[model samples]
Target chain A: MEYIIISTGFALALLGLWGILSQKNLIKIILGFTIFNTGINIVMVSIGYVRGKAAPILDVIKPSEAADKIVDPLPQALVLTAIVIGLGVTALMLVYALNLHREKNSLDINSFKDLKW
Target chain B: MIKKILIIGLLAGVGLIFFDLFNAYQGSEVLGKTGRYYAENGADEVGAANLVTAVIVTYRGLDTLGEVTILFLTAAIISFVLKFRREDFIPNRPVRITSELLDSASQVIVPVIFMVGIYIFINGHLTPGGGFQGGAVIASGVLLMIMANPNFGISHKVIAKVESISGIAFVLIGIMGIFLAGGFLDNRLLGLGNLGELFSAGVIPIIYTFIGLKVGAELSNILGTISHAQNEKN
Candidate 1:
């Protein structure tokens, strides 16, 4: 089950990378970035999941029992922060894309050849 | 042709990385030292029923501070980049009559979403949801309202005020932690009541509430600015 989840994450990441490398439209590239972010999050999450373990909440189990029953909380915490940061980065990228479009009247990566020395 | 080969090579590299990760990941059936320590000590120390909440709010409080600032700065940068152009400030959008059904439906939905968002943040110390998730939900409500009725807009001043106040409160709570407890963002400033109750987690829920409100305000501000910019173009 872990293998399946992890593999899916890797596949998603590769697909995103392909989208980013192949697509000329800035929007597609941004979408690729979001996909990449999701993939990384999924990998992080799946890596932390143990067999038949619960979330690391203290609501159910006693503190002593937590070590046996709970999945790793560190990865979950990191992913949570990463997810929020990813959204911010995505929003910023989209805004930059919008500004680029406004300036050049084009969304194609090839349109701005001046950047390609 | 070269692009195809390059893409394939990249895919092979990615596959190798994943394979390496898979091999390297030795699945632990039990918590490691850090996890075990938190598991054993967190409830008693942080007074939060939810351990994840304890970890985020108390254990790694400084990181959360930096995270919120990143969010705050993103909103600021977004708004700064989209500063008003006088000609476009009036929003030269063509008058498309909004349907009554859509408007009324949103009127019903927005409040419910807002309430749920508040609940998530308020119960951060007891449940799975927290400030970030709750704040995103609330921002989505604002987004729904904006979409349903183009004219139904929130002022930048209102959002800015909410954000500023909440952000100040969050920092003040952290400062209070510094003075009242062992270190910064310590949840032990107030008495740790019974673990499962609403008021049990000393200052975690409060801090999360502040975070939720601040995040919601900032996101709503960013979204509103972006949408207005879109409207200006059309």
Candidate 2:
């Protein structure tokens, strides 16, 4: 199960990288960045997965058995922060894209030659 | 053609690295040292039903503060980048009239969404959701309202006030942690109530509440700024 999730994350990440590299539309590239971000989050969560373990919540499980019964909570916490940060980064990227579009009146990456060598 | 090929080559290399890491990773049968310690002692130490919340709200709380600061900066930077004068504003484009279904449904759904957002953050100590999730949900509610009415003005004054007040409260609680409890941002600043209760984790719920309000305001500010900017065409 963990392997499947981890592999799916990798696949999505690769797909997102392809989108980022090949897409000409600024919005599409931002979409790719978001997909990539989600993929990374998934991979991080899967890394904490323990076989046949419950979630880190102690609602049903006894506190005494929590160490043995639950999956890793640390990664969950780290990924929580990562997810929020990703949202911020994605929002910033979209704002940047909006500004870029306003300046060039085009979403195509090829239209902006100011940074081209 | 060359660019496409180069891109594929780069992706393949990255994929290979991922594959290598994947192959080496044997799913652990047990928690790591830190995770084990938290899992075993977290409930007693934090008195929260959700270990993840215990970890995020208390154990690594300084990181959460940094995360909130980063989000606030992102919103600020977006608004700053998008600042335009009324004199420079282009003529407003034709606003699309939302469908009746959406218009009416949103009126009913938005309040429920807001309530759920509040519930999620309030129950952050016992549930899987937390302040960030709740804030995003609240922002989505704001987004729905904006979508229903393109010209819906979210008062900047209100958003700014909410954000600053919550932010100050968050920091103040953290300061209180130093004086009253262990270190900074300590959830134990307030006495930990009975586990699984609504108010179990001392300052976790309070901090998460503030974090939720601040995040909701920041994100709503970003959404409002961006949506308003849609009217300004060069």
Candidate 3:
């Protein structure tokens, strides 16, 4: 199960890379970035998965038996933080795209040649 | 054509690296030392039934503060970069009227969404959802409101007030933890209450509430800024 999820994450990450590399529109590139961020989050979560273990919540399982009952909590916590940070980063990227579009009146990456060599 | 070929070659090289990393990953049979300790003692020590919440809100709380600061900086930078005079704006484009279904549905659904968002953050200690998730949900609600009415304007003064107040309160609670408990951002400042109860987990709920409010305000501020900036297109 973990392997399957991990593989799926890798696939998504690769797909995102393809999008980033080939896309001409700034918004599409930002979408690729978000997809890449999500793929990484998924891989991190799957790494923390314990086979046949429940979620890290102790609602049903007693606290004494938590070690054997729950999956690792550290990655889940880290991923939670990552998800929030990703949201912030995505918002910032969109704002940047908006400004870029305003400046050039074009969303195509090829149109902006001010910094091109 | 050359650029496309180069891109594919680069991606193939990256894919091979990923494949090698995947091959070497041996799934762990047990939790690491830190994870094991948290799993065993997290509920008892933090009085939060959700172990992930316990880890995020207390065990590694300073990092959470840093995460919030980063979010604040993102919002600040976006606002700074997108600054424009509101009064000077004029929308020359034809206004698109919202559909009747959406217009009516948003009126009924927005309030419910806000309520659910508040509930998620308030029950952070016992549930899978927490402040960030709740804040995002609330921001979605705000987005829906804007979709329903393009003329809708979120008051900058109100959102700024809420954001700053909640952020200051979050820091204040962290400082209180230093004086009242083990160290900074300690959830035990007020003593852990009954586990699985709404009011349990010492200051976790309070801290999460502030975080939720601050995040929601900041995100709403971002959305409002972007949407208002759209008027410049006209």
Candidate 4:
């Protein structure tokens, strides 16, 4: 079941990548990038999962009893970090998009080609 | 069209092979063994039940520092890209608007969001959330305000001061770790006190808080600069 969910996330990510490659609108590209980023983070977090486990916090409960079941907390932490970094990048990209809009008066990427050979 | 289809088919075939190879080696204990090592030893050395946080803030403190530096650099680059000299830039015609409903909504919600961000950052060491996550949340709150009031702008000077102070404090705390604990960003500098306590991670929470503040300010500043530039261009 976990693997199924993870594969679904990966498929979504691939779809997003396809959108990014094929889309003409800059905003669509940015949205695609976001989709891709979220999918990857979900995959990373899922990789650290242990079945039927609670979070890795101490007692509150007995350690010896719960040791066999606690889910790894490390990937959760790493994914949190990744999410923040993704936000920063997305925000930066939005700023760039605004700049592009100002310069070109349009949000279409194909229309703003200045460096084409 | 035919060429595109052929290329995609080739790629799919290659992907299938890779998938098969991965499945063939699946359920092996190679990486799982390493995880088990940390799962066993992490509780003792870090004093935190969450091995992830222990690894992130303590074992990989240097990586965190570097990541913070990257954020700082990004802010710098963004500010540079959108910078306007006082004399050369012309302010665009201001768009007048009146929206009492929007203003009232923002006024009510912004403080709550800000509080939540602070709570997240402060309790990061103890809980799943941390400074980076909280900082971004705070920035989103600021973004909410920005969206609600087009005329309202963050004071550039105040933001600059906040960013610089927080950035400097983050580094200073790291240096304190070095001086006091004999290593840069050493979380054990202040003594890892009783486990699961707020201040137990030594300087980890402190550093994360500073990082949170810095990241929040920088993110807002980036958004502010872009909007300001757009207003100018218009």
Q: Which residue pairs in candidate 2 collide?
A: none
The residue ranges of model 4 lying beyond 4 angstroms of the native Cα positions read A59-67, B2-31, B84-93, B96-98
Indicate the TM-score of model 1. Answer: 0.96
Off by over 4 Å in 1: none
Which tens-of-lDDT digit does each residue in B1-234 have in candidate 3?
999999999999989988997898877778888999998788778999999989998999999999999989998998898887767586543479889999999999999999999999999999899999899889999999988988788999999899999999999999998998888998888879887899899999999999999889989988988888877643
Candidate 4 residue lDDT tens string, B1-234: 885686577557645753663354322212255455555666555565455667777777677777777777777778787766676455543666648887788899999999999988887777777778888899989988887776567998888798788778877777887778867767777777776777676776777788788878888887777767755634
| Top of the candidates by TM-score | 2
For residue B225, model 3's alpha carbon misses the true position, in angstroms, by 0.3
- Every candidate's DockQ is 0.67, 0.90, 0.82, 0.39
Better of 1 and 2 by TM-score: 2
What is the per-candidate TM-score for chain B?
Answer: 0.95, 0.96, 0.95, 0.84
Task: Give stretches of model 2 more than 4 Å off.
Answer: B90-93
- Top lDDT hit: 2
Worst 10 residues of 1 chain A by lDDT: A60-69
Q: Native-contact recovery for every candidate?
A: 0.59, 0.94, 0.80, 0.19
- For A1-117, candidate 3 gives per-residue lDDT tens digits of 889999889888998999999999999999999998888889899989988889988788898888988889999999999998999999998999988988888999999999999
Candidate 1 lDDT tens digits, A1-117: 887788788788888888898899999999999998898899998877888888888787876677787887878888899999999999999999998888899999999888688
